[model samples]
Target: MNDHWENMARQGSRFFGKMTASLSHEIKNALAIINEKAGLLEDFTLMAEQGRGMDPKRLKSLAGDIMKQIQRADGLVKRLNRFAHSADEWVRTVELEEALALILSIAHRPASMREAVLEAEPASTPLQVTTKPFLLENMIWACIEFFLSENQKRIRLIPEKTSDGVRIRFVGDLPLPESSGLLFPGEAEKVLLRALGAELRMKPATGEMVLHLPKGP
Candidate 1:
C-alpha cells in the first residue's frame, strides 16, 4: 500500500505540475490576444477613423464582457485542476461540503446543456471524513448523472454529518419510484460503495437518495 500510494503521488504531482505550466502558457496567449484587441480599439479611438470616434461606452462594455469570460474560465480551470489532483492523496479526511461543491462545478456544464438546474445548500458545519477522494468524486458524479436523467429539471444536494460519518442527500423535485434502486446502485455503484465503506438508500416518498459513508474508507 505504501509503495502504491507513493507511485500515485509522484505521478499525480508530475501531471498537475505539467498541466499547470501548459495552461499558464495558454492563458498568457489568450491574454495577449485580448490585449491586442483592446490596443486596436484604442488606436481606432485615437485615429477617429473616417471622422467617427469609437464610442467609449461601447468599448467599456466590451471590455467588461471579455473580463467576465476570463474570470469564468479561470474559475473552471481551477476547480477541474484541483479535482484532477485529488488522487495525489490515496486517503485523507475531506470536507464533504467542499467535495460536493467541486463535483457540482464539474457537473454544471452538463446540467446546463440538459436545461437542468443543480443546487447545493452549504452545510452549517463541516462534514469531514477519511475517504478516497477520487472515488468519492466518481460516486457523486454518478449520482448526479443518474438523478439528472429523471424528469425533474432541478436537482439539489444536501450535505449532513452523520453520527458515524457523512451523508449527502440527493433530492429530486418529483416523487421517485420505489424501484429507483433497481436502476441505480447497480453493480458498478455497489462496487464503489463497497470500496468506500458506504451505503446508498432510496427514499422514494421523500424523493431523495441518501449516500451514507463511514468515517473511513
Candidate 2:
C-alpha cells in the first residue's frame, strides 16, 4: 500500500508536470502573438505619423484582442503554478473547502471540455484534516478526472457522516465496465492513498463511488 502511495505521487507529479508544461507552451505562443501584434501597432502608428493613412480604431481593436490573450496567458500560468505546488507537504492540516476548490479549479479545463459539471454541496464549516495532503488531493483529483475522461455526465462530491470519519460520495454516471480498471491504473496512486490510510469503494451497479477519510487532528 505504501508503494501504491509512492507510485501515485510519482504519477501525479508527472501528470501535473505535463499539464503545466503544455500550459506554459500555450502561454509562450500567446506572448509571441502579443509581441507581434504590438510591433504591428507600433509600425502602423509610425506610418500614420508620416501622413500615411491608417485606421486608428482597427489598430486599437487589435491591441485590445492582444491584451485579452495576454490576460488569458497570465491566468493559465497562475493556475499551473498552483497545481504544481499541490504536493508541497507530506502531512498537514488542510482546509477541506480550500482543497476542494483548488481541485475544481485545476480540473476546470478538462471538465469544461468534456461538458461535465462538478456539483458541490454548500458546506459552511471547513472540513479540516491532518493527513498526507498531497496524496489525498491526488486521489480526489484522479476520481474527478476519471469521471470526465470516461464521458460521465457529471460528478458530485457529497459529504456524509461516517462511523470513523467523513465519507465523500462521488456520484456520477456509471463508467463502462472496461473503464473500471482505469480508476487507479498505476500502483503509484494506489500505494500513496494506502499509505495515507484511505478507502476507495466503487459500485458501478449502484452508480456510486466513495472515498472515506478520517477527520483532522
lDDT at position 23, candidate 2: 67
Q: State model 1's lDDT.
A: 0.77
Candidate 2 ranges with C-alpha deviation above 4 Å: 1-9, 53-60, 112-121, 159-164, 174-186
Off by over 4 Å in 1: 1-51
Total backbone collisions for each predicted model: 0, 7
What tens-digit string does per-residue lDDT give for candidate 1 at 1-217?
5654554455445434543554555567557766776786777767785687677887887788678657855875786578777878979889888888887766765677688899999887967989988778878877887877876688999998878988999998888888898998765667667668899999988889999999987
Error of 2 at 15 (Å): 3.0
Tens digit of lDDT per residue, candidate 2, span 1-217? Answer: 5655456658777667645655677778789889889888888979989999988788879979898988988887887776667667667887766677766766665677688888777554556677776667677777777677667877887766566766678788664454475654346656655666877777776566788888652
TM-score of every prediction relative to native: 0.78, 0.74
Show pairs that collide, candidate 1: none
Candidate 2 residue pairs in clash (backbone atoms < 3 Å):
4-191, 4-192, 5-191, 5-192, 7-188, 8-188, 8-189
167: Cα error in model 2, Å: 3.7
